[model samples]
Every structure is written in C-alpha cells, then in structure tokens.
Target: MSETNPSDAPSPSDPSSPDAAFAQAAELQRTGAYPEAADAFRRLARETLTLNVATNLGACLIETAEFDEAEHWLLTAARHRPTEPVLRRLLGNLYVEMGQMERAEVEYRTGLAFRPQDAGCELALAGLLLSLGRYAEGWPLQEARAGLNPGVVPPVEVSFPEWQGEPLDGRSILVWYEQGLGDQIQMCRFAQELKARGAAHVALGCRPVLADLLATAPGVDEIVPAPRGETVRIRDYDVWSRYFSLPARLGTTLQTLPTAPYLSARPDRRARWSGASGVGIAWRASPTGFNARNKNVPDDLARRLLDLGATSLHPEDTGVADFADTAAIIERLDLVISIDTSVAHLAGAMGKPCWTLLPRLHCDWRWLRERTDSPWYPSMRLYRQTEVGDWTRVIDEVARDLQARSAA
Candidate 1:
C-alpha cells in the first residue's frame, strides 16, 4: 500500500502555516520516513484535529507499527466521518497489523457496508475469512483481487469469457496464472478437480520457471509457458479463468477440497539427488517484493536449523535453476522445513512431509489461524509464532521436535 496523501490539506502558500507543515509531513510519509511523518502529524493534530490530520496521523502510526496510537487516531477519524469507507479500511489494516482478526473483520465489513465497491476492503475481508477456513464466503470475495490496482493484480488480457460455474463436460478451459509462485503451486491442484468435473481439455498458463514442474501435475493436458513481458495467445479454449479463481468456481469448501498429491519430480532430476537424505530447510522467502521482511526467519535463528543437520535449500546455495530442480531435491530428502514460500508448497504438493513456519503478523490466509495442520496439504504441518517477531521460541520448539524424531 502506498502512503496516504492528504488531499484536503490546505495549500502550502505560507511557509510557516499549518498547511505547509501538513504538506511536509505528507512528503516525509511518501519518502518512507514513517517516524518523522508520525511526529509531524502528531504535532499538527494537537493544533487542530481535522479528519485529514487524524487519518494521515493514523496512517503514519500504522506504518510505524504504533498500533495503540494508530487505533486511537483511526477510530477518532472513523467516528467523525462514519460514512467514510477509507477510514474503516485504514482501521481494518491497523487491526490486522495488531493480530486482531475479529476486529479487523468488523472494520472491513463496516467499510463494505458503507461502500460495497471497496475492492481493497473486500480482498482484505476475503483473506481473513479464508485464513479462518471459511472458504464458502472467502472464495467469492477473493474475486475482488482482480479489481485491485494493476501493480498488485497484473493485467490479464484474454479474449475468452471467464469460466463461471458452467458445465465443463466436453468443454475446454484455460487456467491462466496469477500471483506469486507459491500461489500458483497451491492453486494448480484445482486442475485435476476440473478434469474430474469433465473438462475435456485442461490447459495451464504459468511462468516459464514453473512450466516444467507443473506439467507433471495430473489432468493438465497442456502447459503454456508465460514468458516475461510477452503476450501469450492461447487458442481453441472455450473459456478461461484466473488460476486462483478455480477453487471458487469449483464450489470448494474446507471438507470438499482435493488434498491429494498432484505433482511429481522428473525421474532424471530426482536421480541427481538420489543419495541426498536428511532434512531440507529454507529459512527465507524471496528477498524482493512485498512482505519479504515479515516472512523471513532470522539468519541467526536459521543457523540453528542448519546445526540440526539440515541442508540449505536456497537457490543460491543449491544452484537450482527452477522449481523442477527444487522438487527433485525435495524428493530425495526425508523431510522439509521452510518459511511460507514456494518450497513448502512444492513439498506439500508432491506429498512430502513439510513443516511450515508462519509469522504472527501478515501471515498468509492459506495457513489459517492457530492451525497445526493444513487441509490443502494433508502431509504439511504448521508452526506459527505465538507472539510477533519472536522466532526464538518457534525455532526452539522445532529443534526439540527434530531431536525427538531423530532419537525415534
């Protein structure tokens, strides 16, 4: 999310005016200086508690993770402008940061009530519901993701009509990719479900890196490798839909989800790691992109996993070219332990034992809340932080479990 600009802030014609100070604070926020922005906004709020000042102050506080202060300012703003959906959205985000999912859901719902077309709030509420395993409600709302900003939801240009719940018998459907590699891995299992519903041809359009790996997934008749910056023209498909949307289209609920192994490693690649054994570990998500900082296990804490005789599965350390290579390495390992990344999804998709470590803050919805096992991947176990930014306890618990399993 980009910094909030104070559209109502007065013109900065006078250098000494509160308007100028507000402008300065907004500039600081735009430049990623949260502490300074919060301070400036605080001073401005003391002088005059306008809706603009309160909302901007609340936004800055949220960025700085001063949740208590953020809640006060955001609530003040929301109370003043009860019909303003943006204020409710901001309050919802602040509650999410504070790990108050129930409160967050209330804020999101209130925002939606005020403005049903608020796509951001819809997506946020969808995530919260899905995380709580309320698939029936979540999946439908998740379609709002396509209405988000182009940067968040990449543009998909296709001529085919989106496949709603229409009968798939003797019909062809293209499942085009969206989101990160981990998301693609998680959602690709739906291809087999489509086949079960009698889709005559199930074609998957995916990133080139995953094409080889996902090709092995059952019920996929074709793999269309989506090259970066190049338009992929798929022909002879009766209908098309975003890959993630399939779960909703298929009427998936927690109990009805297909949880079987749907992917496999190539025999040639598996042979490359034939002698490999013991645990495989990945402690970091991709360093680039949104939420990378929150998803990573600290280097110091990660070393503890290495000390337990696990080998690093990072591409830099393993020299893996793509997911296919990673899947092969996982096939040879007895178990995999990873942060919330593609590796965990890959292991789970291949029906390998995997332990996934989840952060308390901004944890992905797929992991759900306080769950020890994943319904999406039956062989997967989840280890989550009891408190924010505290991996020491999580690592300690994993270490003890590893030792006990070794002794057994």
Candidate 2:
C-alpha cells in the first residue's frame, strides 16, 4: 500500500486474490465434498491455467466419476509438465478408477521413476500388480503402504520390534488386523500356520466386533480388541506383525494357499440358527462411495432371490448382532448368495457353500480375473458380471444354479 506496487496489485492468480479458487477446491476435496469440489475446480480451471490447478481439477473429476473429462485434463496437464510426479500419480489414479489397469500401470511407474519414494503411487502400483496375479512383484512393493503419508493413514505407535519372517518358535507374537473385516477374516487363517511353525503363543489385536467370532478360530491363544485411544498391552507380546504380512512371511503361493473352515461358530448360536434349508443372501455392503459402484447387487435381483425361496438373511434383515450371529445363520443355511462383502468372506472362511457376485469392473484383487472358483476358499464360487454394471447375467446364472441345486 505504501507505493501501490504492481506486484502488490490484486492479480487473479495471487494467493490472496479472489480468483485464487484452487485452495477452496482442494479443501473441499480433502473434506470429501467431491461434487462441490469438482464445480469449484472447474471454475478455477476456466479462470487460470496452472499445473497444480489442472491436476487438482482432474483429481476432483475422477472422484466425481467423470473419468473422460479427468483423463482430458490430466493428460493435458502431464503434457505441460511431463516430469511432475503428482500429475503422473493423479493420471494413474484416474486410470485405476476407470478400470484401465494397463494404462494405470504405465502412469504409476512413470510417476515413481521421478519420485521413487512416493508411497501412494507405489501402493497403487502394488495393488494393480497384485490384482493381475503378479504377487512376486506386488508383495514387495506393498511394503510402501506402511510409509504412506499421515493424511492417508493415522500414525500407529509401535512399542516392539516388527517381526520380519524371523523365528517365532520360542517367542510370542502379536498379529494386528490393519484393514477391514473381510481382510481380517482372510488373514486370520495365517495364525494357525504361525502356531504350527512353533510360535509359543499368538495373540490377535483385532476389531471388537470380531472378538467373539475369532475366539472360536483355531490358532489364536488370546484375542485383544484393537486400541482406539486406549492403552494396549502391547508388552504382552515379544514381537508384532501385521495380519496381511503373514502371506509374505509364510511364503504363500497359489499352491500353498490354505483352504477354508478355519473358523467355527459358537455351539449355542449354531444351534439357534440350525435347520434353515434356504439360502442366506446379502445384497449390499457397508455404504461408501467406491463400494457403491461395484459391490451392490440390484434390488430387483435381491427380491428375486427371496421370491425364488431364499431367505432374506442379510444382516440388515436378520438384525445380525455380530459376526457370530452371521456365522450361526451361515452354518445353518444350505447356500449363501452375496455381493462382495464381509458376509461373503465369513461364509467362505467357514467353508459354507457360497456364491459371490462380483462386478465386472474394478473387482477386488482377491477375486482375480475370470475365475469361477476361489483358491483361497475351496467352497466359494464366483459369479462375475459379464460386462460392467450388468448384474443381470450374474443373477440369471445364479438363479438357474439355485433352481437346479434345489430341484436336485
């Protein structure tokens, strides 16, 4: 104000100026208000053109499921700043959202070449490789997930040394569940193996919801609820390991993957749900934006299953109190029909006859591609969509099979 300098003028692109709208857009994106953020970013892109602004707009578009526009913006931005790692990562993320794995791989690799230590990009690449069944490369790169930034993951305080495939014959180990319910169910299979390998005792630090169910699991000597701003008895174990890390530690290949029925339901609960000859059905998963797209079966199909004599045994309908309750019903059911959700995992883990309905695009890595049966769960059958968002074919096939099995 002293001299009214040109540099001090209200330039549109200046951080303090009215046209500097990228900050607001970015903040909205961070808060998960994607549609609003996308609008704000679009305004910013029209007013000013910068690498950061364009990349953010592209990312917001991806979140809003406007993949074609996102590709346009990200590709244009990448051309302007070819070596910018963030832009490359953003583009990679867009490809992944669109289910374009090969293109996504290229963009992620290119970004990592410029910023080798970028944890998010590395993890994306790891997931992509794993989904393609390239476990040898994927598992090693997945270690980068532990190094992800604080914003993406909350910091975990580690009191003891991490167990890295070391001898556990004379020592106790704590296996902590780091991810979701299905992930914990799948990985808990490793505890029995850890015990067989001579860990003196194995304690599981897991979600409180699964504590009762997991207590009946074969190999866990103790079950502790995951710490949530509460003090944990971490000192009880000599060493700690992550649930998912057990695969690599155990050197699990496709051939060595364990079969199911590793978990059991309470005798009392099993007795309660006993004698149901109809199928148990789960049509929807826990609601989230990403999960909304691929993990839900059509409501009509769900109704059709019930019409075809299957019972509406989804947790929402059955008023499931816990995993134990769900397991009890599953143990009683003749078959389980589900979208890819924790229920499917539970049924499969318990060695129940389970048919999982999978989305054609962006399916989970564990399902792999174009497979009818799961190696991880010997009793599980997969019915995948023949095309994106087409649950009709999957539902028809399931209905035919159900009719055939019932008729038999």
Candidate 3:
C-alpha cells in the first residue's frame, strides 16, 4: 500500500490540541513509522473514537500486519459513516491483505454501489475477481484503472480509434505497451491471436530494452520503440489498444487463454549462453516500489538456492544489457526459479520450465489464488506463501521439489 499523505490532517492553533496529536500521528504514518503511528493513534482513539482516529489507526495497524485490530478499527469507522466509499475501499484492501477474498469483493462492491465511479474501488474489485478467475466480470471493470490518480495505465495520445473487438481482417492494430516489462511479456502472446484473426499487421509500441526481445514474438510485424522523453507516433495502424486490454477485447477465459511459446531467444544469443546450466534464480523484484519489500526474498534465504547449484540471473550480477540477454540465458538453463517478476514472465513466454514464488500480501492477480499451476504458462509451477511475510515454508517446498525433480 502506498503511504497516505499527512497534508490532509487537521492543523492545530495550539501545540497541545488533539488536532496537533492527529497531525503527529499522520506524519508518522506517512513516514512509514507504522508502529509509532499506531501507538499515537491508539492513544488518540482512547481519548476520542472519531472517524479520523479510527481510520488512521486502522491504516497503521494494517501496515504492521495487525489484521484483526485493523478490521476492528476500519469497521468502527465504516459504522460511523456507512456511506463513505473510502472506508469501504480501506476495508476491501484490508480483506485482501488478510486473504479474505470473498469479504474483499463484498467491500469493493459496496464501495462501488455508494460511488459508482470510484476508480480505486473498481480496480480493487477487478483484481479480486481476476484473482478468483472470474475473467468475464473482471476484465470490463479493469478499464477503471486508467481513472486512478497516478494512473495504472500509461498515458498515450493517438489518432487511431481504440480497438474494441472490431474486425481486423487485412487491417493494422497497434498493441501499445502499458505497465511493466512482465506485463508486456505476458500479454504479447495476443499478437499471435490477432494474426490468426486476420490482422494484416501487429505492431508493438514498447520500451527499447524490450525491442529486440519482443521483435521475436509471434505475429509481430513492426517494433515501435517507446523511448522516454520522446513522443512516439505510429499513425500507420487502423486501431490501437493497450497491451492488457487484449484479453477483455478477445473475450479470453482461463480455458481459452493462448498458452503457447510465442517468443524465442535468437539462435545466436542462445548459442552465446549455451554454457549456462542448472537453475537460473531471481530472488528479488524491482527494489524501488512499495510492494518490493514483500515481493523480494531476503538475501540470506535466497542464498540457499545457490547451495543447490543455482546461478543468479540478476542483470547487475550477470552484466546483461537487456531482457534479450536474460531470455538467452534462460533458454540455456534447465529451470528458472524466480519471484513474481519479469524473468518469470519471460521464461514462461518462451515455454521454459519456471517456478514462481508468490507473496501472501499484494500478490499479482495473474497468479490467481491457491493454485500450484498456471494456465497462462503451461510449463510453470507456482509456490505461494501460506502466511503473510513468511518465505521459509515456500522456499522449503521449492527446495524439496527441485531435489525430487533432479532425482527423477
């Protein structure tokens, strides 16, 4: 969860005022001192159980993983202002963190009922539904993601009409990249589907780092590099769509997902990394996000994979320039063991054997819930955390499975 800004806190004319206390607590919360913030909020709650205090306390409790207490305070605030959509979203987020997905869905829907245009609530519901494999309902609601503050969908300006399941026979369609590399890698498979449906050309607008790699994706006729600080204009396509929107437009369900190797390492690049063997491991996701801490395996815990003869696949360690190099390395490896990150997606896209480690909190919707296998990647296995902030059990299981596979 992103930190809540303290600027919204009530200002006090006097230092000793309750308003001043609230400001202090809010600042602590904003600065990520959750335990201290929770303590301050608890004291304020004892003095007066206002909605502000209850809500702030609830958020802090959630950061500290005090789910039961968080639920109590959040529900208390909700009871005070039952019509507040924000409170319902908070409750929904809390339920998701606690693995109470059904309750999360209820809270999200209640928020939407109160404010039908609540983008955050809609996005939350979309994620929950998709995680539960209710794709038909989830995909439509996911469009609200663009309406969010600090929007989840990338901003783009183009003259071409947005594709909405229109006929593409002998016409061009541009699949513009959105979100992260992993997202593009996973969704690029749709290019083949578009081709099969008779699109004359499938063009990808993607980051330059991905240009060489995604050029090899099936049905791709053009690579429009989306470099930073430069406007990308591809007026050639008849229609354009965000990469993620393809599933919704195509009416994709779990069973109908295009699960095939739509990407390949260049023959020369694969030959360059032919010496690579054993397990290729990535224990960390991007280190600069709110969810990074939860997604990353502790260095000490990850070193256990090294003991099992796994080699690190991190770009920093491997001195690789781009994903093409990583794909080449993965092509030569027997298996890939990674956290939920781009490497896992790249490996899965290439139909390589991959085992993805999933965190209990804020796990991506693509992995779905309580499943050891992925429909999106037929050759991939999933290892999920059973408890929040715990990796030992998941890693233990992976180790056992790796040993068993080797024995076989």
Candidate 4:
C-alpha cells in the first residue's frame, strides 16, 4: 500500500525541521493522540532511522480510522517485524471492519498462535466466529469477551444453582439489562419466562427512557433505571442473567429464536398506532449498517419510503421533523418498517406488524444469516440487502411486497 504523505511530507534532508517533532510524535502515541501521532510520524519521515518508529506510526494510523493507509503502513512495518503479534491482530481487526471474514480469521488465528493469552485477539476471533454463525466453534471462545471491556456489566455468577423450572416458589431473581434498548427489549422475553419458572420477584435495571416500556414487560417486579454515575447494585437474588445472554444460556439455536412477541406496548399506544395499514419507520442510526459493508442511508430514502403512499412515522423524527403530533402520527400506523435499530425493537415489543430492513452482514446474534423473517420477533419481517449498498433492490422488493400485501 502506498503511504499517503502530505505534499510537504518531511524528509531527513530538511534543515529547518524541529528536533521536538520526533519526541512529540512519541508522546502523542502514548497519549492516544493518534491522528496527530500519524501526522507527526509522517512529518518525521526524514528522521526514519528505525522500524520501531514506523510500527508506532502505523498503529497511530489504525487508531485514526485510516484503514487503507493503516494497512499500507502496517504491512510495510510487518515486513520488518513479521513476527510481531500485535501486527497480526491489528490486521485481523481491520479485516473484520473491512468485512473480509475469512482473511480476518486467518490473521486472528495466526496471532493467537504466537500470543494465545491475548484477551483482545481472543475476543475478536470469537466475535468473528459467532458473526459467521460458526457457533459450535465460537461459543467457547465467546466466553472470553465477558467483562473484557469497561462499562460492560459483569456476568452474574451463580453459586447456589441455576433455576430449571418453577423456582419461583417465592425466590427473587435479578434480570440484568445489556447493551441497547433493542437488546433489552429482545431480552425482556426472559423476564416473563423467569416469572413462569417461579421467580416471583424479578428486578430489572435499564435505561430510564425505557422505564415506561419495561413496565409493560409481564414478569418484572421492579424496574430500575440506571442514571449516569449511579449504578444499580443488587445485594441478593436467587439467580441472574443478562438479557441477550439468555438465549445462549438457554441453548437457543437459529431454529429456535423465541419467535413469539413477548412484549406488548401500552393499550393506549397500540390503539393510537392502529389503522387499516401502518408501518413503523426508522432510517438513520449510528452503527446503522455495521454489517453488509455499512452503507449509512441518506435522507432521500426516507422521503421515498414516505412517498409510497403508506403511513410513515420517522423513528428519528423526535423534534427534527414537524411531525404533526407524536400520538397522532403513530396512532394511524398499521405496520412498521425499520432499520436494525431501537425502533425495530419498539415495533416488535408493541406487537405491531413490522418489516425490519436489514443489511447483509447484519448485527451479531441477528443470526438470521440468510432468512427473510426473524424467528425472534413474531410479527416482524426482514428485507435484506441482495448486495452491499444495494438498497434500491431491497426497496423495490419491499415496494412490490407492500403492493401485493395491500392488494391481498
């Protein structure tokens, strides 16, 4: 890969170069000022007296989200230190982001051979395996990701026993929320299941915004919203489970993804959203397309979806659009059409009929690898990318389906 240097990329012959630049570059890397570090390294190109500086410079590029340039720099540095374990892991992560799953697996496996104890590489390789639906091989590795990062809640350790069935004689069980609202919604299914199993008191901790939504979850005895800086620490409970981890613990497979809708929205909210035909809509979101090579949709597509003469409510239209009124806009909707975001969860939880838009690679545990409908959300349908960035085909298919469904 060709290194992209500024037009005035520094060379060793320059007499005016400052001596502090080299030292500053080193400091920048240590301080995590990766972009500046990359820039400073490029500026000190003339002072390139060692391979260590080049490796550090390449790492800085990786941190700065310059993958193409990062690859070039690291590939060059790797030639000098082909035996460095970090380079292989870094290349593997880059491949993961680039959607080169097979290549990433090789790189990760290669790095693990040299540095098996590296938790980071272990976590990445496990995640890749799981994303590819290679579960038989991935589950053991996936365990390494537990508590690996900060801000992640630790998994509950059961010393007494994991309740099999009808444990609720009167014992309380804690239900831990994980990740996003969507994750929580999907996981809430376990709360009801826990209740049925005799967990009489099921305490839940989740984001405050979802308090009302969670209130509607059948099994929760208490809903605690976690505030910034304040954590929900439970003193005791007979059992515990992270919502998303429920399936894995319960031995869920692609064939059995808890298809029935376990959550239903408030009767009032449901009534307001009912009509002859309604479709929930969610367009843009961060991590919008982490799968399918990640194409962030433009506003134009939202306008097109709206123009389909179907009832449309923006999942993101909180004050951005002069949405006539939230209740009114949502009330007359018959179905939901959404991206893989919180709105999809909302629609599913509401038990409203919905068609979830999907990216090809998809998010982890969406494990609906090639299916058009998800077994996880009963009324929700899926429209997937035929090819990367090919939303037009997906849209046309959706349009045709809508016409046929409406006609039927």
Candidate 5:
C-alpha cells in the first residue's frame, strides 16, 4: 500500500511499459494517496487501454469525484472482466459513492455470495442497506465498522461517557453527534426514544449554526458546540453514544422506530417562514468527493426552477450565489426542495416540509429494495430518478408540483 507520487509515474514512452505504471497507481490508491494515484493512471490510460489500467484509473477518478470519466473506466473494466468478483466489487464501491445503492447492492451481494466473509464487501453491503433506511437488513452488514469507527472519527478529545445499550433510567448523558448533518437529524429521533427509556438530559453535540434551531428537537435538553480535542463537563451525565449508533444500540428497525416528527424549528423562524403552504429547498452539499457528484443538481436546473414561477428562495450560501453555508438558508425559507444532503435534514429537523430528490441508484442505505418515502423523517417526501442521469424529469415533476402548490 505504499504510495508513490503521481509525479513518479513511469514515462509512457519508457521501455518498461504500462503495467508498472498501473501497479504504481494501484499502490498509491492503497496508501490513501489519491492525487498521485490519479496522475499515475492518467499516464497509463493515454498510452494503452487495459482492464487493469481502466479499473485503477476509474477508482482514482472516483476519489477525485470525476464521475463522468470514472464511469467510463469502470464500465470498460466491467466489460473486460465480466466474471471477476473483485472487479465487480470495485464497481459496487463506485456505485455507492455515486449514491447508486441498488446497483451497489447487486455487486456487493454477488461478491459476497462468492467471498462471504469479506470485510470490505460486508461493510459496503451494510452501509448500503443502512443509507436506504432498510434498518432490518443493514444493521448486521453495517456492523463491520464496529471496531473501526473510533479509529476513523476525529477523536472527541475529551474524557466522557461513550453511551451504548438500553437507557439507564433518569440519567443525563451527552448524545454525541458525528458524520454529516443528515446523519445527526436522522439520529435525533433516537433522542426522544432515549428519554422515554429513562434518559433525562440529552446534551446534543452540534455545530453552532444548528444548536439553537435543533434545541427544540425531540429528546434533546441542550445543544453545545464541540471544540477539536477539547473535553467538556459531563455534569451529571453518565455516557455518550454516537448519533447513528442509536438505532443499533436500541435494537430498532423501521417497524419499531420512533418514526414520527421528532425535530422542531426555532419558534421565531417558524412564524417568519409561514406562507401559502410553506416549503424548503437545498440543492447542494459540500461540493467535493462523492457528495458533489451525488447531491448537487445542475445549476441550470436550480435556475430553471426559479424561472418556473416558484417562490423559491435560494436555500444555500444566500449572500453569495448557489447553495452554501446552510444555516442562513434555513433561516429564510419556509420549505426546501433539495437533493439528499444535510440541508434536507436541517429542514426536516425544523419540521419544515421538504421534497428530497434521489438519484436512481442512490446511496447504499437508501436501499435498492425499497420505499420512496423516508421513515426517518416524516415531513420529508422522496422523489427518485427512474434512470441514471435523468434528474431533469424529477426536477420537472417537483417544479410542476410546487408550481401547482403555489397556484393553490
């Protein structure tokens, strides 16, 4: 897994050839060195085309969030090695990154059937199921990260309780938040459930922007911003559990979930947002990595919706153009029409009506075998793509629906 610098790619015209270059790229990718990996692969691809080169190039491209080119390499690799489980697994990972879970599941399941206990395959399968809201199926698969979660997360930097298992009647504990905002909102439902089981104070770990807005969310007693590596007072609290880990700790499935509106808005924002059938919109996430490819709708699509005579508020990066720094966006709008990202969660937590757009393949946990509506957030509606890259139709449908709503 030792990574070589991209600048270290063997010269294409060098007599030694593309195999060395590809091997070098693959090593770079393994070492978590992406930039170098990408340069190495690009060199190999220009001189000759091969399944090995294409697959590695595709993987590097995915790391760069260059889906257009990555898809081409992955598809080419798939064609060259149709029966290879490893190659197929790589495709599944790409699919998962692109928010295409159904296709990812197919690849993961196919690979799992051959190499049943493969940890990588299992984790991917679990994550795919979890993201889809397929709680029942995903929990077991997703547990592969049981030991690794702590390693990957930037440490809490404080000595505090790590909450796990059934509620200790009437004990206060910090319910730690992690991952993206979408995860925090989805997991907020667990806060109330924890309270019902004997948790009295749920001090939420949250970003400053979300603190006040989510204070009224169900199951929370307070909200605090976390400082990197800084520890805070536990003050009568017994433990902390990761937000997403709540479901697993609680033995929950979609059927047993507290599938109700568990989050509420700042009462002040609520009054201001009310209008003729209020709604919200968020069309982008931090535009880097897998999120960029999956979450952002085309800007023209966003502009088009504005043109359609919808009273659409620019739901992100309000001061500047395009969706960014969501708190400001949430403060202004009544409802949100957005792709599946943190903004959707923020609006949902505010108890705002949201229409969430989903790619056809979708994220792994969004599940291939499933429902259009999200059980995690009752106020949110799901609109999915019928085919890949066909966002226009979905956008049109949403625009038409919103336009109709505006008229009514």
Candidate 6:
C-alpha cells in the first residue's frame, strides 16, 4: 500500500516524477475518478515502469475497458514481478472480461501458487469454477471470500458457530443475506430447507427493502431488517451460516433444486395494483455498487418492448418504496421481462413467468452457460445475446415469443 498527501500538487513543468505522478494517479483512483486516474497512470507508466504504477495503471485501463493497453501493461508488470499474485489476479480478471476462462484459470492458479493465501485469486478461481458449473469444486473455494474487503459483498461476522448442514432438532440458526437483493431472494429458499431440517426457529436477516417482501417466504419464522451496507443485528441465534452457502453445505445439485414458488406476495398489496394481466417490464437496473456492468440492458429497451403492446409494470413507476411494493405489482402481471436484476429473482421466487435477457459477457453463474432456462427458478426463461452488446437480437426473439403467445 502507498500513501500520498492529498494537498500536495505536482509541479506543472515536470509533473511526471514517479512519486508525485503515482501519488496523483493513486489519489484519482481512490476518489473514484477512474478516467483521470487511467490517463495519469498511463503517463506514469510511459515515464517509468514500476510494479505499482504498471499494476495500478492496468487496473484503471481494465475498468475503462481499454483491454489491449491493460493487457500490455499487466503482462509487463507480471513479467517484472513474476511472484506478485496481485498482478496475476488482475490479469486473470482481464481474461475473464475477454471470455477466456482457461487463461483466466491459469492466471488465478498461478497467482495462488505464488501467494497461497491470496483471497482475491482464490475468489476469482471459485467464481470461474462456479461459472463453469463445477459446483463441487467451487463452493468450498468460495469460503475464501470471507473477511475480504474487495467490495464484492459486505463482511459477515458472528460469534456463534457455523452450521454445516447438520440436523437441528432443538437448535436455532441465523441465515444472513449476502450481496445484492437478487442474491438474497435467490438464496432465501434455503431458509425453508433449514426449517424443514427441524430447526427450532429460523431467523432470516435481509436488506430492509426486501424484509417485508421476503417475510412471506416459507420457513422464515423471524424477519430481521438488515439495512443495505449496515451490519445486521444478530441476536439469540445458536448457530449461523450465510444463506448462499447453504447449497454447498447441503450438497445440492441441479437435480436437488427446491420446489418453485416458495415465496408469496401480500394479497392485500396485490389487490391495490390489480388490473388486466398485462406484461411487466424492467430494463435499466440500479447502477449502484459492484454490478454496474454486464447485467444492465439498454435504457431504451423498455420503450421498445412497449411499442409491441407490452405495458409498463415496472415498480419504479408506482413510487415503489421497496421490494414489497415491487412484489405487489409483479403478483398481478401476466409475465415479467427484465434484465438481470432483483425483479427477475422476485418474479421467479413467486413462480411468475419471467424472461431474463442476459449479457453475452460475464453472465451470472446461476444462469449457467448457453441455457434457455434456469435450474434455480423453474418458471424463469433466459434469453442470451448472440454477441456482446447485442440486445437487439435478444429483444427480437422475446418480441417474437410475445407475439406467438398473443396469437395463441
């Protein structure tokens, strides 16, 4: 790690000094000014090639999708410091973006070989294995993600012991939600599994926005509202486990997927928004947090769907306060068409017909590769891009399907 004085301005005439230039670039990157940081880092790399400069510059280039430059700099830096796991991890990420999974695996494994405890490399490898549908190899590796500060998910801390799929006839377990809303929704189904295993009581913690909606989910005896980005208030639980980890601990496979429609929306809430069984659409996803890429459909896709007689049932239009509000509207819609967002998960949880449009690159591991359907959500259908950024093809196919449904 490096430190720089925020007030120290580099001299204008000779600003490319390693310390000053690196400091400036580091400051820009720290402040989330990525484009400026990329430019500064490029200049620094041109002047002098230090591992820090090269690696940091490579990271910025990757963020900006300047892959060629990123690869050059990252490879150069890795060559310079062959033992450096961080550089290899960065290179692995670059390969993932380029859809070269094998190369990415080699880089990640090589990185781990050099630094066996590198959580980032381990997590990268875990995700790669999961994406390839190697659940047995991937899930145990996923435990490496705990206590990591790399911003993928929030930290989970508990004083109680972790329950690893053991029977709990007279015990209690706390199931804390992890990651985004969709992740919470998708994994909450396991809370029911825990209850079915004879737990005395199951306390489910979730994002406050989803607590109300998820209250109706089976086996959630208690709903604790864990506000987004805030540590959950854990109380009176004998043992705990991350909700997402339940599958691996339970030795679950595609064939062992739980029954569908384990969640239900409030009937009174749904009645307020009841209308004709029109199609629901949600195009743009919230741009906040780590999922800012690879999932969002173009903003105009909703309008395009509307042109073909699809009605706007997006919760955002109804002054929707939370997932509860969103769930209410989804309950009445005949079908939901969305990008890879929480809405898709909600629709799937409720056993509604949902068609999710997936990006060509970095589609979620749960969706698997080249699949038209989801194993986790039986009612959900997947429409994938034929090429990168090719939403038009996905939308066209969806439109054709919609027309056929109408005709029938």
Q: What is the C-alpha lDDT of each candidate?
A: 0.83, 0.76, 0.84, 0.62, 0.64, 0.77
Candidate 3: Cα lDDT at 181: 80
**lDDT per residue, candidate 4, 1-408, as tens digits?**
222221111111223335577667767676656678788888766555345456556666655557688777667766766656667767776676566778989988887887785676776787787666665566556656556644554455546454443346678866666666666777787777666656679888777767666776777888877764665555677766566455555555555555565555455554443443455466665552233224344567666767776544553544422111333344346777777776677677656777877764334545335576666677778777766456777778877887787788
lDDT of 6 by residue, 187-299 (tens): 88887778778888888888788888888988888888876556556776888888777888877767777957978778767766665367888787777644446567676
Q: List the residue pairs that clash in candidate 3.
A: none
Error of 6 at 17 (Å): 8.3
Per-candidate clashes come to 0, 0, 0, 16, 27, 0
Best by TM-score: 3
Q: Model 4 Cα displacement at 139 (Å)? A: 4.4
- Give one digit per residue, the lDDT tens place, for model 1 in 1-408: 213333322111123345778778878776657789889989988887667778878887776678899889878777778777778778887887787888899999998998996887898889889988899999999999987756545676767788998899999999888888888999899888999899999999889999999999999999999877777777868898887788889999999988999989998788776777899999988865446666789999999989989999998999888899988899888999999999999999999999999987678888887789999899999999887678999999999999998999
lDDT of 5 by residue, 1-408 (tens): 122211111121222344676666677776657668878877877887655667777777766667778888778776655656665667787777676768888998887787776666777777777666677777756655545455333345446667668556978777765665566666776778788788878888865545665676777788777554565554545777667667777888867867566555445544444443445455666653234565568878877776765344444323322112344445466567878776677666555678888865434354333466666667778888776567899888998888788788
Instruction: State the lDDT of candidate 2 residue by residue for 253-327, as single tens digits.
Output: 777787858887888787666666678888887764345556788799788888998887666678778898888
Flag the better candidate by TM-score, 1 or 6.
1
Top lDDT hit: 3
> Which order, best to worst by lDDT?
3, 1, 6, 2, 5, 4
Native-referenced Cα lDDT, model 4: 0.62
Error of 5 at 362 (Å): 4.4
* Alpha-carbon TM-score of each model against the true structure: 0.90, 0.84, 0.91, 0.69, 0.70, 0.86
Whole-model lDDT, model 1: 0.83
Q: Clash pairs of candidate 2? A: none
Tell me the lDDT of candidate 5.
0.64
Regions of model 4 farther than 4 Å from truth? 1-86, 94-103, 136-140, 143-146, 152-170, 195-198, 233-235, 268-277, 286-295, 310-332, 349-351, 360-370, 385-393, 403-408
